[model samples]
Target: MKRNPVRVTRAAGDIGAQLSAWRRMQSLTAVQVAERANISRDTLRRLEHGDPGVSWGTVLAVARALGALDRVVDALDPFQTDLGRARAAAALPKRVRQ
Candidate 1:
């Protein structure tokens, strides 16, 4: 399957911007959050800029460090997705066509 890098990159950038804002709102410095997440400040900076070069674990750790891990988990929860529920329903054949 083909993937669109632009869309992915844009999403990452948006998330990073939000994260950066959250850090500021919580009066956190990059070093503070990075220390909490057990990552380097450089890594945290890359994440904040939405570089997409960081590990998924690092992303989750960042969220955890900021006490927003629940949001991250909810974002990826398939059961909470209406489109997924609709598509899953469509996948099940209600009657045999043959």
Candidate 2:
């Protein structure tokens, strides 16, 4: 079992609201989304509310159900992140010709 946090970032809340809005726009109920994601409605509720206790798999599943899998995939892509790239470059012992 995962422990939930005391607070979440604004981005987390925004993402949750966005996911909820998208589900509403697609005419999907929480039960329907949960069924499609093979997760319980309660779990989906936690995920939709941005509870940190929820697994990334559950979040991805919900994204997939909402046809936003690409967005989630892109979000995890290292090349898509400047901070990640900078950190990787900084960690290298030798500098590569850019």
Candidate 3:
């Protein structure tokens, strides 16, 4: 009964799969990753299974444990894409007054 948009669900699944692939590529077991991320094995399993309810902190912790934190952070850089760059160059609203 999750109410996430289809795109969000798909993105979660992709990210989960990629994390699993990274763990396998590094020869790290689930227990090792869970310990390294300082999270419970159940949490890691839920994250790896693409549960969108996983916390952002948990995602960042897992990424850091897997040495992919930089990549994850960089992927959010607005200046990295043409559209983002263009948007950045344009004047944007500072804040909306309620």
Report the number of the highest-lDDT candidate. 3
Model 1 lDDT per residue over 1-98, tens place? 55559988898888888888889999999999999999999999998998866788998898999999999898898768999888878897889888
> What are the TM-scores, per candidate, against the unseen true structure?
0.79, 0.69, 0.86
Candidate 1 yields a Cα-based lDDT of 0.89
**Off by more than 4 A, model 2:** 1-9, 81-98
Q: Could you give me the TM-score of model 1 versus the true structure? A: 0.79
Candidate 3: the clashing residue pairs are: none
Choose the strongest candidate by TM-score. 3
lDDT of 3 by residue, 26-58 (tens): 999999999999999999998898988999999
Candidate 3: stretches off by over 4 Å: 92-98
Per-residue lDDT over 1-98 for candidate 2, one digit per residue giving the tens place of the 0 to 100 score: 65435456455666778888889999999999999989999988877787666787888898999999998788889877898889888887685587
* C-alpha lDDT (0 to 100) for residue 91 of candidate 3: 58
| Model 2 lDDT on a 0 to 1 scale | 0.83
The residue pairs that clash in candidate 1, if any, are none
